[model samples]
Target chain A: MNPRLVFKAALVCLLLVLLAEGVLTLAKRHAPFFRLFQNQIVSCEILDDLAACSLKSGRPLIVVMGDSVVYGSDLHAHGVPHWREQALAAGLQRQLPQATVLDLSLDGALPGDYLGLYAAARRLKPDWIIFEYNYRMFSQKFGSPSEAVSRPWLRGLMSQPLFPALPQTAGDKIKSVLRKVSQLYRYAEAFRDAFFFPSREEVINRLLAQVLPSRSLRDPGDREMLLKLKIKPHYYTPLLTPEHAGLQAVQLLENELRRDQQPHLAFFTPQNQEYITEIADPHTWPRNLAILDSILGSLADQKRFFYWNWGALYPADAFYDHCHLVPRYNETFAKMLAGIIADGGRRDHVQRLE
Target chain B: MFNGWNENIRAFLLGLAFFLLLILILIFGQDLSSSKFIYVDF
Candidate 1:
């Protein structure tokens, strides 16, 4: 081949890559570009604090933080009433009409993210703080727990426990830089989410379910498939362990809350026990729940914070998956949470008067 | 040698065209009405 031809081919490939990157960046920036096919594109503004978004000055403020569970991934396809934050706010407003609720939860938010959210939220002097506890999130490992501890913002906030520290290598640093610079690298996950998995029918069905009150969000065929599948007994064993980084991260959050003299509520979000029981060994399933409940219960007790282990509150069908509650159940859960918060507030008021 | 070089150049051009076509399909085939925000799971 001629050297000129080789150079031309290389140049074409480079141009194509850059063009693809530009398209992806545009899709990310503008919602209309990605929404035509009924795809739910997630775009969030980067704000320093939750209060920065919008706040009612005189109302008592409540801030809740957690992962996708709290962010309401299952409800995204559904319309307004089904969103967890919206439902919860509506419920809370009914009970405490003057209070404001700020949901700081995002998808894939770990305890580390909560630590940052909490730090920022504290500046706003919220009346109450609620953190959603999902056992599945406990299995996540931090990249550099030691380095996180050393950071000035995280200093005195996060601490390393018995979990192994994953140091940031030179390769990791280079990859991080590349991920930031390369649009394809940055939006790879979004691309997969947009085109892959959850066939078009499934997405349509979810929307239909939201509109039609009688229709189930999950397809009967999908439910039948899930029923036939069995999960490994040891799947949750790593997360059940006491020394996992996730648990330690929660501990760090608890410590910081205590030091700051902040009163908070930590609730164990409902899990699909029926699915767990079917997939996991009978002996191991109960043990796993027991271990997790004990850890969280003990932490709440130690910190004098309100805790509710509502893991088994919902029926098996309420879950679209092993973890996320369907929109209807999410609304019910929010109402229950609002009731609990109201009750806690009343009890505190009575105690203070006494 | 000239014939072999010509074949190689043709093959390279064909491959490059295929690659560009794939990228174009991905860009144009994308659904644009999605209102969902990105959620990160721990």
Candidate 2:
């Protein structure tokens, strides 16, 4: 019960927490322990470096960016025929044999992140840039693009507006301090993810699913399984009004590309219509699509870039979930995209001749 | 008699115990269901 004993105990606890956090950080980077969860954990930095290297290769480079759909989450555990690799194998490379395709997509990436990525990627002078425009990200407001890659504490602090009108209560201020200072508090999500490791059977199933050709087939069971996954309906919320920050970021991205005379394509990626219809209110579904189309259409018209709304292009069977395409459809989607790009290039060439 | 030194020791012990309990809960009692890696919303 001595004060010195109490002080010693507190110091020991702090040191233990710090040591555990350090180990977790190292595991995140080097340890093979986390590789089992690769389906969920994406290394954005590695993807960025790969894209940058591809860009600098002096070949005509095509950079693709977006959220999980573009990250090919639906192709989880499947080793061969990744969307990017299939795009190349599906004659995308052969069509433009001198060009290279680099996918810079990551899970949860937004327009703000895309803006920052474009800024970084443009320096490498890619011939064409394609960004998947998921309507959901456009509806949500975003923090600063530059801070997206900063350290957790700095990112959380810098993401806040410089001059906030509302005064913070003492409790709010205390929580903020804890969030910034406590490694345990800041990396709670990471810890949770690490703790919930998938079983070996599940991991094996995912891997086998990747290799087995029948696994990609459009089964009636897919609908029930997808429904069981609890795909949230909130994503279909009709942004009756546009989010200014998102629009501005998209506008800025378009303006920069046009100024640099770079060819860019913004494609409205497909979503599972069956899932959307089942989950979303009938009125909200069409309204949301219209609102998204209007924004992308206006941007394309204003910036003189190509914007194609392919949201309903693929059937519900083409998707494993509400958003991502099944691995079987990757080649088809790639060929469709290549056709568009190739056709666009021929049209531009003809226009130049005129 | 509970003097100032005794009182300070009691408060310090209570604080230390509380923090240790919290750290233990975080380390062992994490919700396994809360580990979906991708944020579906954004």
Candidate 3:
């Protein structure tokens, strides 16, 4: 073995890898490209991204948190897909141009996610936290733990023990250290998908669309089928009591936020009331949110913590389906939220950033 | 021909190709999204 030749080759490879990582790191700073792969973000990986997130010091930061209702697909909209740009955060950004809006929401996210998200958002030092309080979260009928909550990283977040009793394996320790050191290794999926055309998902989806009947996960075109087959069973389940994992996670998130003196605003996720009544048993389902509403209402301090039931506020047309809002309605939703966050209930701060 | 400078350059190119291919496969081969995840399991 020639040590000199090996060293030269190793140095060349290292430089090439570093060069690639440098480009990805720089591209991740640009918000549009940065958010392109936001779906793949796990709880554990958020802090590093937030730490490197650059914002103008004077600009007030508003972190919007929730699930698909807060960040829905643009599959419904024709012409071209704008994805997150047409979602709630961008709508809020438009409404409150003075402040920077960070959409920390994801598809199928639950209350169990917010603890990890809030933990990550604290790094951003946000002025206001606006989130969707989806009533469906109260239903433990989904999965025992749910795939959303059982993500490898999220499994650990949910298992927050009083002591560091859990043992880490050799591989876990190495991965943890590597994640801390290398953004490339940590978000390799995001970087690769962003750089590749017709991404790996798109490729699989195109191929799968051939053999499988359903092509997309949240295809807006599938609403009629979703309503007939899936919606009733999913939404009409009995509300799990206070002991529900999601409710417990919500309580913990609220408690931590209060301890940190962080102000937050949450509205009962608005749905198409017309369609809801069709599936809902009237006493349960949608009423589950109302039940939770009274419970949350007991602790409501509008000055610091704002929670309201806004489920029936919008018309059927306002929603893309039964839950998510259309882009124009999203702007309306943003305006209403901005009014509260800017006014601070007492009109303490400027109503708008400019 | 085996002892020529061209052979050394060819070997370096071959090694670099193998390294890049390995990296590319590792990065893009797998689907991170859950296979059995149903969207309506709200």
Candidate 4:
């Protein structure tokens, strides 16, 4: 055989093998991809889905929607009893003694994200929703709250392609498609993790000893620097907004609740004494107070609404750092919530429907 | 009747064909496993 012919035949064989491999890989993961389908397909959604399914079928949800603080970082990841470490259901059982508490919080969520969730909750008909606004809630500082609307249906309309509020462009369509593809990858990753990888708690435990070394979270200056980088700390990005934007977020959320006639409780999570003192200069603290006051005033007559200012509740030692409540504080916070649910709100309806 | 142009062209084409064939083999041999390692502790 001529050398040329041999080379051509070899090349063709290689091409066939590559094509076959591609086809097989695509076929095997197709279903998983479709199930997950999002940008940078992350396992985050898979976990969210599993939790959502449980909430949907088992009982009325008591969602705790907010940012990373809700995920319980200050609490030791392994099994150390911390804020969210306690099974919310068990705690609710002790308090309400009848209803179940289903925490649907995801770390890194903002007010806008919470609004998205609130809209979903409306459809699900959750009995109670706690809109826990941590320090990051006012980070945006956008002024002038958006007009309140009665229909929760319109919340995501503007952000999604279906709404005319956002301009639909070719680039946007491409981005949307890419996001879907990424989501598929994420689903696959999550599925893979579910089977092969260690649970998040386990992994966090292993790394915690090494990464966090001291019980003390990184030095305050170090954390502040990291926050400025717009990296590890999820709050920094949102905090960059003008002060007014942040306040607007709270106002709009309140207005939204009023329009939907949904019952909600908003709490400003406890920050360590350091963060409080650092921000405590008479000006900033009062400004923050004003924002919270304004939000409460808007709902003044709606006796159903409640607010917990941890600033007055826990001591400085109760914090992991400037912003996060340490684990001990988490237990205290959980107990506080339980007490409030048990005694503060409407007594006749407390677990009455259940 | 000793022209090198034809010989060079033939050699180049042969090499190109071989390269393509090798790629095809790798692609076809790819694993279809949906399972992936999220993090591996060494």
**Per-model TM values vs. the true structure:** 0.56, 0.56, 0.74, 0.55
Judge candidate 4 at residue A1 and give its lDDT.
57
Q: Of 2 and 3, which scores higher on TM-score?
A: 3
In candidate 3 chain B, where is summed lDDT lowest over 10 consecutive residues? B33-42
**Reference contacts preserved by each model:** 0.23, 0.09, 0.11, 0.09
Clashes of 3: 0
Q: Put down candidate 3 lDDT per residue, A1-354, tens digits, no spaces.
A: 566666666666676668767876786555445555564554344544554553544688888887767766432233236756777888888888988787777555677677767766686778888868776666655334443352334334332521134455675566556555665665664444344322333445456667776655336556367545655665777765765666666677777778888888877788788778887667677467766787666556878987777777788888766787877777777777777787884433212221
Highest TM-score model number: 3
Error of 1 at A282 (Å): 2.4
Against the true structure, candidate 1 reaches a TM-score of: 0.56
Model 1: CA > 4 A from native: A1-49, A52-56, A77-96, A139-164, A170-239, A302-304, A345-354, B1-42
Ranking by DockQ: 3, 1, 2, 4
Enumerate the candidates' DockQ scores in order.
Answer: 0.15, 0.10, 0.27, 0.07
First chain TM-score in every candidate?
0.60, 0.59, 0.75, 0.59
For model 2, how does the per-residue alpha-carbon lDDT over A1-354 read when each residue is reduced to its tens digit?
A: 676767766776676677766775555454245434432333333334455556557676887777767666445423344444443233345556667765556555666556656665666577778888775564432323322321122223333332233355564465457654554654553444344332222443556668884873334476356444434444545454543455555666677777878788787788788777766657766776787677777767524377877777777788766677766566566666676676663223211000
lDDT of 1 by residue, A315-338 (tens): 788876666777666666666666
Off by over 4 Å in 4: A1-58, A77-97, A140-243, A279-281, A300-302, A344-354, B1-42
Tens digit of per-residue lDDT, candidate 4, span A127-206? 66776665544443212233221112123223321223535456445534533444332233334344322233345444
lDDT of 1 by residue, B1-42 (tens): 456666556756765896656655544333224322232221
Q: lDDT tens string, model 2, B1-42?
A: 556556556655666676667765654554323332223322
Candidates sorted by TM-score, best first: 3, 1, 2, 4
Q: Second chain of candidate 3: TM-score?
A: 0.57
